[model samples]
Target: MLVGTIMRKIKSRTWKKQRYFKLQDDCMTIWYKSKKLFPSLICVPLFPVSVSDVEAIREGHQSEVLLSIADEFPADRCFTLVFRGRRGNLDLVAESAEEAQSWIRGIRKLMENLENMGQRERLDQWIGDWFRKADKNNDGRMNFREHHARLFSFFQMADRSQSGTLEDDEFVLFYKMLTQREDVLRVFQQFSLDGQTLSQSDLEDFLRDGQLEGDNVQQHAETLIQRYEPSDTAKLLNAMTFDGFLMYLGSSEGSIFNPRWREIFQDMSQPLCHYFISSSHNTYLMEDQLRGQSSVEGYIRALSRGCRCVEVDCWDGANGEPIVYHGHTFTSRILFKDVVTAVGNYAFKVSEYPVILSMENHCSVEQQRVMARHLNQILGNKLLKSTLDGKAAVGLPSPEDLKGKILLKAKKLGGLEESFSGTADDSQTGEVSSGKSPPSYNLKDYSRLCLCVRLLVSYLNNIVFESPHSQKLTFISPVFLFPQKSKQRLSKELSDCVVYCKSVHFSNFKHSHIHSKFYEVASFTESKARRHLRDTGGEFVHHNCRQLTRVYPSGFRTDSSNFNPQEMWNAGCQIVALNFQTAGEGMDLNDGMFRQNGGCGYVLKPGFMREAEKTFDPETPQKRDGYQPVALTIQVISGQQLPKVNIKEDSIVDPLVRVEIYGVPLDQNRQETRYIDNNGFNPVWYDTLRFTVHAPELAMVRFVVEDYDKTSKNDFVGQYALPLRCMQQGYRHIHLLSKDGTSIPPSSLFVHIRITELE
Candidate 1:
């Protein structure tokens, strides 16, 4: 296929220009260039997007900006490339339908290859990417200057005959020097008879002794030799070369995350309250909470990343419409209708599980009604307006029963029986009259208004018939209570949309256990949730098993920073909401937690957390039943192709690795390796770190690489995080990610992991 073509780039309605787009020969990067007066300027780059970075390819003007220009551009010729994480989408318009199809098909094929790439293939690609970056002149060779200072010694050593440049065999020698791992070499030589290559028996011994492979060690060794042996002669002899040995250790077979857990292996049939949901707080804001831009892009980003619950703070807008924003804050606003549309489009694009629209409604009754109409119309059947079954059940429905559905989590008023029984009307009338009633209204008028409100709700209920008569339905009414009332009156139309997760004020665990239904949900600020966890963690865990709980960040975090979600998760809180807009350790932990279970937005809670009989408190993990602690030993061996912390030409990082264990308070700990001065490339550590995890199932292990400094805190380079239970035991490669959780390819740590159960 032709790798390059001209396409019109669409940034906005008025910004559309022809640009040359090219897929590099590596098949991993797509580079584009705008026409310039000088040829030199044309060669200057905008940016190159990696094929693996693309989350999805949306066709036919799926993005808002693209859809806005539909009248000018042909729908068949327009498409959007949605990048992973928080990166903006790339919208382009082809000159012809054929060209658009060709580009789309070609990119899809490349993406498929990326997805199916084996361990060795991925390593080779990573190496090729590094070589390409170092080959500054693009001449298929690297000169001494392009090798950088950290590698200058290796470059000089590999450049035989004082050529000042390396090519072919010479380049291979340089690569070997660049990637040499003394730690792995020492282990390899210890097992090899010739101190060169390992025979099948020798490999088996290493697998049995070093990797702790129990049964069928010989078969596993043979498979590794066959699959990873780069030299054909060694493969024929049932032996593995050092290159092949390293390849095997870097492959998926050597990954820290267990391959079995990579799939959806957990039981997903449990009730919604029993699972930990990936949720977002202030999801509409792209930056800080105080003055951030509110855009529909936020909804798309969160949903596409497998966030099952998103906050939408609705406030009254012009023309009786509702706007979503951080209420009373300086943040910008987006139409509530647009948010609904975005959610409806992208909710099921990544995961088939149900999504919760966590509504923080501050809109007036009129605008609230508009919000309800928009959700009902835009979402259509995707909206869950009633319970799944005709009859009310003892517990909330499972995620399996609510697939592809969107549930509203908002305040609801009195139940249908009470609303139509005259009791509710009398109470509402008295409440309205007892408070500061409007001057135009008399006692008779107040009574009549309350009656009319009840009749209107009953008539709407009869027409919609959202649920069967067997169920006790609760619908919110638009009739506003007087100024003295603490809470805003909810619109019945919007309230009817909330079927499973009815938002309720939380008083105490005892009160909730007595009065709250399975469908009732309570939200807590970080401060309040922390207080509960600190004082009565067992009760908090018990409360979460029956009723859903959402823990959000404190309001004082005006910068939209996130709190550690692991704390809430420790309490079995189903919806631990975080500021998805920010990228830090908090968000990294959030991303790591949700990266498992096939990124399905719902992860089944640990068995102990789900069982009501077990009083497993995060504060006192050792008291839990069957609490078997685990001793985890990790040897930080080396780093490969570590990225520079800054863009300065002379910046040579003194890199260090820190391993952190996050779980119960008892298990939380961190240890670090001594810094390697002036070495970011192939820096060797071989430092061993250990931890005792009290709750392995709830623990997460994080590997962080930072550039050490003498006068200040270390600068972050990259890190990788995953549940400790998913961590594999063996020599493995920890692929590092940037602060934003995007892959920093070729930048990884080589480590050995051993986990032993302690009695």
Candidate 2:
């Protein structure tokens, strides 16, 4: 077991104590127990942690809790275990550095074993977990009551000897009855020769007809039988049992999402503008804009979630450094250098794709220089200081071409020509030389106003005003006017960092086409972008095809709410930034869109949207060239092991499944099933929902389960969303996720999907 350690488990700075820790014999779990004396209790309660659940291990005082106690503990003896999804981190300090390394290496080795497990081994592990949960008394056996009342009747039927507890053979029978689906059984019987097992030829026929397997159906069926059949006799006889069929249906092969799309299979060599980049707005804020906490945690969370573009709002800080936060609100501030360091560390951790730092600069020229210095030194070679291969004349580089690089997106004093010519002053003092009036650059040139940093002004009536870029300003209650200050000089050090994605004032389609370069980008508020989509949808699509466009949430949403990004993507907007800290249907849709192509944070736009000659408008999809619609049919069969939203022991949920489609306006639709009263354990509703998707390429399907309440709004239980194109046909399992998009174990919906082309 190799269990030897006395480590301090830290909950926070003040909450830390020594605990007895040991690794179990299976090498898959670690147990930590409190050493506090309890005369009445027979044994010390031990908490077990599965190595498979741990996402990563950070050495030293990397976490906030660990950093808080850094002065008390040496870095080498400390480590943090980061669990997947929304689980909090676990910080620990060992007695010695060698001890910490032993635990880290041991856990990592067990995790490697878990990752390398075969399909059958994983399924056995899952079943073993269920067995352990059911064996509540630690007796390695389960009775009818321990399995829950929902399966009590089936358990009794399987227990022929009238015993309260079921033996292994009896438990197998009970399990088969508990999980048996009549629909699947009927299909199996139809495909079986003796109405008991599927022979090789029968399996081949089913694969060809039901699964749409082509050419090599016989070989594929043989492979599947050998892989999933639990019975060795079935493998020897080239046959499959009903249990094997069900196992195959629940695995990744039968998942709605195509397994092939779970890798980097997309054409990442296309220009950056030709893809929908996963972008985040005001990424530093963890809550509402007016009053929120700003920390590097927000950056780490977003970047690790495969966010390619993150917004950073920088203002002047103390000691000649710059700070990042919501410009003038009550939101807290974090050092600019810390954010840069965090971004550098986590940029390529999840996906080895380029990251774009969307800079919202409001600092003085001196502080801006400090920000540039932090970016240059902390980020080092990761930051793109110049155009790749000096290809500014060609066009914006592709994601593949700039992998592991960070692009700066902000206002620049001039283009690459001015930056390289050495005509731009690197040290222009922003103050007009002892308080002289600010000189006017070309009044017609809107770039000067864009380049000039804005000082937030607000009335004293406790009223907050939103700046032009959606940053809120807070001031006291007497209405006052803050006049335009002298033009703030641009730091050439920072300006040189903007090789691509230089922010510019977006006037109109004609202005951009005539004057703007491919590397230049424009920002738009949700309202403005919607207006353009309504008026000049085709023109907006054409603009996005050539240059990148970022559409952010409107300033009025101080609550940090997000708008539906699917509509923006429908119009070919490359960067549809959302408040990542906020979780809602908007974030759900964003997660769904980026959940394809290995979630590299870049998904290729639809062929029609990326076409050089713009012919398709989202508003008029029917009139577009080469448009063909598809009919999607989904049969909601049943839900398994649904979680109870209310923790009250006596309370039960009446769950209903809703199928929603998000795509072009014409294809947006929703249909739901009737609620199954007081049955969250195994709810069945053979309800069939249908959708006609006009633009199938841009369509997304979302499955949501809610506890039905006629008196009030339905309480959310779980949901799953994915692109329509990534969906696999035939029978599949839709594994449900919690509200925050984390998988809820043993909770899923089984369904049959069919997509057919329309005339």
Clashing pairs in 2: 460-476, 460-477, 460-478, 461-477
Residue 505, candidate 2: Cα error in Å is: 2.1
Residue 125 in model 2: lDDT: 69
Model 2 C-alpha RMSD vs. true structure (Å) is 6.9
Badly placed stretches (over 4 Å) of model 2 are 1-4, 11-16, 20-53, 68-72, 113-148, 158-176, 420-486
Off by over 4 Å in 1: 1-4, 24-29, 38-42, 50-52, 118-132, 135-142, 150-153, 167-169, 193-201, 215-219, 222-226, 230-241, 415-485
Candidate no. 2 TM-score: 0.87
lDDT of 2 by residue, 1-759 (tens): 354567899988999988877776556667777767333222243677877778789999887778789999999999999876656678999999999998888888887888777645764566566667668787867887676656567878988878788776677677657655776787788888899999999999888777666679888899999888999999999999998998887788878888899888999998999999999999998789888888777888888889999999998899998999876477988989889988999999999999999998878888988988999999999999887886435688899999999999987766776665666556543222111222333322423343333322424223453345565654432212233333446777788788888887777999998998998888999999999998999899989889999999997798999999988998899899999888879988899888899989999998888887758888889898889999999999898768889855455789999999998889999999999998876788989998899999999889999999999999999999999999988778888887877666668898888899999
**Against the true structure, what is each candidate's TM-score?**
0.87, 0.87
Q: What is the C-alpha lDDT of each candidate?
A: 0.83, 0.83
